[model samples]
Target: MNENKTHDLEKERQYYTNQTKELLQNLKEINEQKELTESELREQVMARIGAEKQLQAAEKALEHLEMALKMTGAQMTELQEHIMPDVHKLREYFEQCAQEAQLEANRAGIMRQAIYARK
Candidate 1:
C-alpha cells in the first residue's frame, strides 16, 4: 500500500508539471502576440505622423503659392495701368515715324521719275 501511494503521488506530480509547462507556453504566446500588436500600433502611429507633416508642408506651400499669385496679379495690374499706356504711345510714335519715312521715299521716287521723263 505504501508503494501504491508513492506511485500515485509521482504521477500527480508529473501531471502537474506538464500542466505548468503548457500554461507557461500559453503565457509566452500571449506575450508575443501583445508585442506584435504593440509594434503594429507603433508603426501605424508613425505613418500617421508622417502624413500629418506632409499635409502641413503642403498647406504651407499652398499659402506661399497663393501669396505669389496675389503679388503677380498686382504686378500685372501695375503693368497694365501704368506701363502699357507708355508702351502703346511708343508704338504709335514708331508707326508715325515709319509713315513719314515712307512718304519721303515716295516723294523722292516721284522726283526721280519726273527727272527721268524730262531727260
Candidate 2:
C-alpha cells in the first residue's frame, strides 16, 4: 500500500517537527532571560539534553521501524499517540522551571540594585 506508507511517513515527519519546535522554543526563551546562576543553567541544560535524547531516540526508532515495516508491517501510530502527552508535560515542566529561574534572577538583580542605591 503505497498510499498508506506515504501517510505514515508524513505523520512521522510531523511528529519530529513538533518535537524540534518545542525544544527550540524553550531553549530560546531560557537564553533570552538574564544571566542564570550555576544551578539554573544546569537545569536548563538538563532539560535541553533530555529533549535532545528523546528526539534522537525517536529518530532511531523511526529508522528501525522503516526498515522493519517491509518485514513486519508495524505501525507507528501507537507510539505517537502514547508519547505525545508525556512530551507535552515535559515541555511544560521545563518552561515552568525556566520561568522560576528567571524570576529568581530578576529578584536578585533588584535586591542588588536596592542595596547599591542605599550605599
Candidate 3:
C-alpha cells in the first residue's frame, strides 16, 4: 500500500510537470505574438506620421503656389492697366520715326539717280 501511494504520487508529479511545460510553451507563444503585434503597430504608426508630414508639406507648397499665382495676376493687371498705354504710345512714336526715315531715304535715292543720269 505504501509503494502504491508512492507510485501514484510519482505519476501525479510527472503529469503536473508535463502540464507546466505545456503552459510555459503556450505563454512563450503568446508573448511572441504580442511582440509581433506591437511591432506591426509601431510600423503602421510611423508610416502614418510620415504620410501626414508629406501631406502638410504639400499643403504648404500649394499655399506658396497660390501666393505666387496671385502676385503674377497682379503684375499682369498692372501691365494691362498702367504700362500698356505707354507702350502703345512709344510704339506709335517709333512708327512715325520709321516712316519719316523711309521718306528721307526715298528722296536721297531719287537725287542720286538724277545725278547719275546727268553724268
- Candidate 1: list runs displaced more than 4 Å: 74-119
Worst 10 residues of 3 by lDDT: 110-119
lDDT of 3 by residue, 1-119 (tens): 99999999999999999999999999898778666655665565566556556555655655565455456765478655665565556556555655655565565556546544543
Q: What is the lDDT of residue 25 in candidate 2?
A: 96
Question: What is the C-alpha lDDT profile of model 1 across 1-119, one tens digit per residue?
Answer: 99999999999999999999999999898778666655665565566556556555655655565455456766478655665565556556555655655565565556546544543
Best by TM-score: 3
* Error of model 3, residue 8, in angstroms: 1.2
Decide which is better by TM-score, 1 or 3: 3
Clashes of 1: 0
lDDT accuracy of residue 85 in candidate 2 = 60
What TM-score does model 1 achieve against the real structure? 0.55
TM-scores of all predicted structures: 0.55, 0.39, 0.58
lDDT digits (tens) for residues 5-111 of candidate 2:
99999999999999999999987776555334434545655665676566557656655654554444337657656665665565566557656656665665665
Candidate 3: lDDT of 112?
A: 49
